[model samples]
Every structure is written in C-alpha cells, then in structure tokens.
Target: MRIAVAGSTGLVGSQVVAVAKAAGHSVVGLAREDGVDLTSPVGLDERLAGVEALVDVTQSPTIDIEAVKFFETVAANLGDAATSAGVSRTVLLSIIGVDRVPQYDYYVAKVAQERTHRVHSPGLHVLRAAQFLDFPGMAIRWGRDGDTTTVDDLLSQPVAVGEIARVLVELATGERDDDVIELAGPRQERIVDLARRLVAHSGEHLTVIARDVPEPMRNGALLPGSGAIIAGPTFDEWLSRQPA
Candidate 1:
C-alpha cells in the first residue's frame, strides 16, 4: 500500500511513518519539512499521487477562532487532494471527547476537521485516543519553573505514542468503517503522579501544582469510558524506558 502521512515529522505522525514502513508498506511523508503544507495544499496533488491511504496527524498551536480556521483549512485541503488522488481511505487522529464536552478552540477545530472529512470523504476512519504520557512534561515546561507545586490529583489515562502509532497503522491497512475508534492507556493515573514520574525519570526534581486549569486546557475528557479499548503500555512502564 502507498501511504501518505501528513505531519510526518510530528511526535505521533513520525511514529506512524515508522510503523508503516516496518510493516512493509510504502510510505510518503508530507509536511512543511517535506515541502508540502497541508494547510495550503500547494504541492498536495503531486505528493498524494499514487497514495492509497492518507493518515492526518497534523497539529497547530492556535487558539480561539484561529485554531478552528486552521483545522478547517487543513481538512478541506486534505480531503480534496486525497479524493483527487484516488485515495481509498483517509484516517484522522482526533482527541477523545471532542464532541462530548465543551473544550477550547482547539477541540472545536478538531470537530470541524472530523465533520469536513465525514462530508467530503465518507470513507474516513477517525481514531480518538487519550493524552500522551509526555503531555504533562510539555505542560510543566510550558508552565512555571519552580518545584513547589505537585499536580498528582487530576485524572488522566496517558497512552504511549508508539502504541498509538501502531494502532493507526493497523487501521490504515484495514477497511475504513467510517466509525470512531477509541483507545487509551492500560491504566489510569492522576496528572500530578504522571508529571512527578516524568520529572523523576529526567533526574530532576519539580513540583507539579494542580490548580484549577482553564477548561480549554483540562483533559477531563481523555479518560476512558466503560468498555472502551484500553490498549498500550502503562505509564510507569513507558516512564521506565525514558533516559535519565
């Protein structure tokens, strides 16, 4: 199969590309680094040529109206280009609870992306997964620098990025059921605990204060529901592999 992965350089997309190649599939990478901007579709038609499937794992850091517009544009461009290229299936990586709860601008953008694919490309497969275990590290780095606060009480099930990538490849090679598949980590842990574990793994001491994070930033919806697929290595297992 000829697979084209958008945002192939991102944390998750990069893994997807690796997994696809390891599975014996021909993979093409499309990203700004690869001279294909998904938001504009400037070189999409040429890049998507001979692509049997497209996995969209693109991301942007916009907020408010800008975020929504960015995803909407990317979705439109990808859908059109994939259709023109005779792509049979389109797979999208989405966050869990995008439609269940009222999240910030980014969630709205995700909803728009999903809707665009549904209407424009009916053969789309949407996979929703929980937050990555490394997400708390990102949050802490983006937050303050002190070691006084610990945020171990917030609920989250952090899945490994590699596991998510493998599942995506599985979906890519299978039929597109046009249904949403939900995946999560093997165990549930508080955000603070996860953060602390991550910090400890880095051989650093940092306090993760759990405050009333803004609703847009809170990942309450990332938790798995009853009977939802709980896949991938546990957080502690993944943490143990981190370099100190």
Candidate 2:
C-alpha cells in the first residue's frame, strides 16, 4: 500500500508514518517541513500520485476562528488533489464530541472540517479520537500563568498518540465499512487530576487549578461512545516510562 500522511511530522502523524513503513508500505509525508504547504498546496497532486490512502492529522495552532479557515482550506485542497491523483481513501482525524461543543472555537473549527471533507473528499472516513494521554502537558503550557496553571475539570478517556496512529493506519488500509469511528483510552479520568500529576511528576513548582467548563463538556460529552474502540496504556503505566 502507498500512503500519504498530512502533517506527517506531528505527534500522531509521525507515528502513523513509522507504523505504516514498518508494515511494508510506502509513505509520503505531506507537510510544510517536507515542502508541501497544506493551506495552499502547489503540485499536491503530484505528491499524492500512486498513493492509495491519505490520512489527515493536520492541526491548527490557533484556538480561534482562524482555525476554521485553515481546516476548510486544507480539506478542500487535499480532497481535490487526492481526487485528481486517483487516491482511493482519505481519512480525517477529528476530536470526539466536537459537535457537542459549539461555544468553543476549536471544536467548531473541527466540525467545519468534517463537513467540508464530506462534501469535497471521496471515500472520506472520519476518525474521531479521544484526547491524547499527554494533553495535560499541553494544558500546562496553554494555561500557565507564572506559578499557577489552570485546567478543565472535565472528564476524558485519553488515548496514547501511538495507539491513535496504529488505528489510523488500520483504518486507511482496511475496508471502509463505516463513515465514522471513534477511538479512546481504556479508562476515564479527570483532566485536572492528570495535569496535577504531570506537574508533580515533572517536579514543576506550578500549582494546578481546576476550572469548570461548559455543560456539555462537564457532562461527559467529550467521552467516547460505547461503540468506540478502546486501547492504550493507563496514565500511570505511561507516566512511569517518562523521565521524572
């Protein structure tokens, strides 16, 4: 199989590239670092030539409306280029429950991406993944204010990035029976707790604070459904492998 991974250098995409190659598949990395601009890609069709599947793990740094424009443009470009190049499958990695959080700009942007891809991309498969296990580190960076870090008090079943990547490759190469599939970790946990543990494990002096979010988030909207696939090491298991 010949596969192209958009955002191929990212946390999940990189793993996908590695896993696919290890499984004896040809892989192309579609990323700015790899000389492919997703927002306004030039010669993208050439890059995707002979590619059997294209898995999009792209992300926007912004949490505002700008993210909406970024995803929409990239999806349209990828969809068109893949069609022209005769790519068989196009997979999009999305967040679980993005539709339930309209008030949040990032979630809104994700929903828009899903909608755009459905319209433009042929053989589109939506893979709604749970929060990553290391997301607490991101929360610490995003919410940091001197010595204090604020995080959401919401619950989540955060999967490992490697697990997500493996599943993405599986979905890309296997038969496409479902339009949408959700993936999550093995157990539910509080985001705030994970943040505090990460801070403590890292020996950081910052105090972790919990903040209440919107109702949907607080009421388990971010959690994967019963039909979702669950696989990954627990936080404690993964944390033990990390350097203190």
TM-scores of the candidates in the order shown = 0.89, 0.97
- Residue 237's lDDT within candidate 1 is 79
- Candidate-wise lDDT, in order: 0.79, 0.91
Candidate 1: RMSD to truth: 2.6
Clashing pairs in 2: none
State in Å the error of residue 32, model 1. Answer: 0.7
Tens digits of per-residue lDDT, candidate 2, 61-155, equal: 79888999999999999999999999989899999999998988899999999998988787898889989998988988999999998998878
Error of 2 at 69 (Å): 0.4
Worst 10 residues of 2 by lDDT: 170-179
lDDT of 1 at 117: 83
